[model samples]
Target chain A: MRRAFTEELQFISDQLVEMTRLTSTALDRATTALLTADLELAEAVISADDTIDLVRRDLDSRAVDVLARQQPVATDLRQLVMAMRMSSDLERMGDLARHVAKLTRLRYPHKVLRGPLEPMFTRMAEVAEDLVAEAGRIIANNDVEAVPQLLVTDDEMDELHREVFRTLLADDWGHGVEAAIDATLLSRYYERFGDHAVSIAQRVVYLVTGEWPEEDLHIEERMDVSRVEPLG
Target chain B: MRRAFTEELQFISDQLVEMTRLTSTALDRATTALLTADLELAEAVISADDTIDLVRRDLDSRAVDVLARQQPVATDLRQLVMAMRMSSDLERMGDLARHVAKLTRLRYPHKVLRGPLEPMFTRMAEVAEDLVAEAGRIIANNDVEAVPQLLVTDDEMDELHREVFRTLLADDWGHGVEAAIDATLLSRYYERFGDHAVSIAQRVVYLVTGEWPEEDLHIEERMDVSRVEPLG
Candidate 1:
């Protein structure tokens, strides 16, 4: 019975890693689609989101089943509960990717990120990729050390988010109000993607080390959006 | 043992209802702060968010404790799990309200919503209040009937979201790019608040009636963001 419980836990862990992989691929393709206005690629990303959602639902149900069968206590019970949460964070990451794809489709034949916005978003995508990949590794191997590096990557994503605002608010910005609105929403989608990845990594580290990262505990509050004040 | 489990479930349900109340107050006050540029009101909303987070943590720990002590199976296990999910949704609604307050504080003494944006946001806040209040009632009473009404309110929020874009993209938009960026982010925040409320209400209806709402299953995907297309 003990051996079977361990196997179930391992299966759930593997599915979570798979979710990270799917979201990473989705976000990468969505970025490419947005950059080039590739309608076909965007459509694919939008449609593939269902697979991620299904995986999450399957993983969550299995976790509950294990709880019902095994009646895990203490550390074991907490682990199952946290697995459900990690799956939620990953599912949301996939949703953010789909949001990007939908926006791309909404603006078909017209590239959404051009001029200064292009390079900042490109860098944001890179940071988001690194964060999700590291989150996957941490979950798979229980590598707590990778968390600090992941937090740094999240910082980069936040900086890029602020930079997007700066570019939009610049005096010579010629993209007009419409483009600014698009940039604002698109930048938020990418930044939120990174936030969800950081959340997953933090959960894994907590499960392994039993200690929440001190400085990054209230990460949702540390968004540094204060710097995003609009120019009068 | 069964009697104790029932009592514990009642406690968890009460806490969930309390969460809805806190978030409703937070959003309502945050909207006022944004429109009035009242720094103190915004500060109050921001600081009070920690209370909501604490309540969620307390509720979650208790839920886990009940799961361990009772070793409930089948529907009982599912109820505990779904309670955790509902608490998460409510906690996130609080975070969204905090986001609005933070934005308000960041732009102290400067109103974020003006002109046509004012009336629209006023209505969005009103809808948000209704959705959350109804979510509380549904959880408290298992009132499946309220779900349809809550969904209609969600649709109104979506329409308001589209109107926000139309106002920004109009040829005669007088606000600069900075204000437009702020408006875009703020509008998305209110819309997402509505989405989380709809998700909570749907979860309650599913738990009570054993049937998911057919039309609103994927509330996230039906965000109608496609209608937010930027004008050339």
Candidate 2:
């Protein structure tokens, strides 16, 4: 019974790792669709979400079954529980991916965004994909060292995201209003995906080290976000 | 030993309930800030995040301690694992609330989003907050019946989100590109937060019932999404 239970957990963990990898790839493809204005690839990403949803359902069910039948305790239980939560996060990340894909679909042919916005998308895509891969590796190797990698990637993503906001908010960025709006919405999607990826990485670090990395997280979440000064 | 373990598990469960409540309240404030453009409330919400983060770290440490020390098997183990997992989800949901709050600080002034757009925000807020609360109640009471509440709330959020999208994307809508972009990003944040809440409710339901909602989440997920046909 003990051996079977361990095997079941490992099986679930492996599946989680696999599903996470696929989720990352989905985001990567969706980004490509957006940048290259490929409606077909975007549609494929949208349809492919069904598969992620299925994997998510499977993972959730399997985690529950393992909990019921095998009855996990302490460390093993934590791993199983973490896997289930990460499954939901990864699945939602896939949805955001589809949202980007939807953007590609909506604005195809005419290229609604400004040419300068391309690097922002490129940087967003790079960081998003790297974080996904990082999360997958975290689960697979159960590595403690991967936390920094994820943090650094989030930094890179946030910097690119700020640039996106600054350009749009600028007076003379000159994409005009409509294209600027497209750029803004797309930036929000990218930034949030980066946040989810950070959450996953945090979970992975905890799984391995049982440490919360509290100090580090505080720094990452820190922003110039301040009270809106009274209008002069 | 078993009784002590159960008590500790119950304590963690209580924390989860409390954390969920805190998140819901914060979300309420965040949405209010979004609607009223209350920079003070938005600032307060942003600052309050530290408390949420602290609670999250505490929960993680406790769960990990219970797991590594007790090595539980079965339902007892499941509860511990789920507690940890739920805490993380709640934590991230808090972050999403924080995101909404920060968006309010961006000077979009909720007053401008009047008429149906206004009601749409109100409706989205109601559903989002209720879903968070329902998920909490489900876990707190272990009420399987409450699972359907989340489903209904999710459906409502989706519908409202679609309405927002249609208005923003319509050529006759008359708003410039900036407003449209803002609407899309804001609605997405609301929609995705609702999705997380539903997923949490589903987990709570599955925790007790050993199954996810059988009525088809895939259809539900795609239903509210704006189906703007790709520009050929």
- Assess each model's interface with DockQ, reporting 2 decimals per model: 0.66, 0.29
lDDT of 1 by residue, B104-182 (tens): 9877778887678999999999999999999999999989888888888888988888888899888778977777888
Across A1-232, the per-residue lDDT of candidate 2 in tens digits comes to 9899878878888887888788888889998888788989999999999898999878877886776666566667778777877887788788888888887787777564685788878888888888888878887887768778788887777777777766766567765655765676677667767777777777777777777677446643532222111111
Q: What C-alpha lDDT does candidate 2 achieve relative to the native structure? A: 0.73
Q: lDDT tens string, model 2, B1-232?
A: 8888888888888898888888888889998887888989988998898788889878877876776667676666667666776776787778778877776776655443544577788888888888888888888888888677678778777778767866665667665554555566667667767776776676676578766567546633433343422222
Q: Judged by DockQ cut-offs, is candidate 1 incorrect, acceptable, medium or high? A: medium
TM-score of each: 0.97, 0.77
TM-score (C-alpha, index-matched) for candidate 1: 0.97
Candidate 1 off by > 4 Å: A227-232, B227-232
What's the distance in Å from true for residue A146, model 1? Answer: 1.0
Worst 10 residues of 2 chain A by lDDT: A223-232
